[model samples]
Target: MKEGRRVYGAEDDDPPGPQPGHEYVELVGGALDGQLLDVTSWAGEDREGGAMLITENGLHGPGGRADYEPRPGTPDKWDWQGDYP
Candidate 1:
């Protein structure tokens, strides 16, 4: 396994919580709704700190609830938005 990478527990194992070196992410708009925002420092679980908001304009960081609204009728999918440098 890679360094700082977190592994999810098996079906019979306990759930892994708040992993170190791991940041939770979520997509806000576009075709990739409810997807993981792979863009580093772009978006994350608010509980972790704050989530970045991405739009047709560009990437915004440390955003709050008032930042952007998610699109309706988008299915929650685990899709990769792409990697960040």
Candidate 2:
């Protein structure tokens, strides 16, 4: 992994992103709707645990966190669970 690279959010300016062996998952619903998630170094459990995405306009409003989980049978998508403080 490159320095300063966060393997959570998929939008990056880094060159040759989504490198070989890495995967990008499309998000559904919530504040980060339609955005892709980076799971390059994630294991099966990591993917299952999902991620708490930080956002200013998440389900709980400004400065809240967006909860997203993997969609069953879909290896390239994450469904929004909700958001919280």
TM-score of each: 0.22, 0.72
Each prediction's total of clashing residue pairs, residues at least 3 apart in sequence or on different chains, is: 0, 0
lDDT agreement with native, every candidate: 0.34, 0.73
* lDDT value, residue 70 of candidate 1: 30
In model 2, what lDDT does residue 35 have?
A: 66
Give the alpha carbon lDDT tens digit for every residue of 1-85 in model 2.
3333334444557644445566778778988886667776688788888888888887577779988888888857889898989
Best by TM-score: 2
Candidate number of the best lDDT: 2
- 10 residues in a row with least lDDT, candidate 2: 1-10
List clashing residue pairs in candidate 2.
none
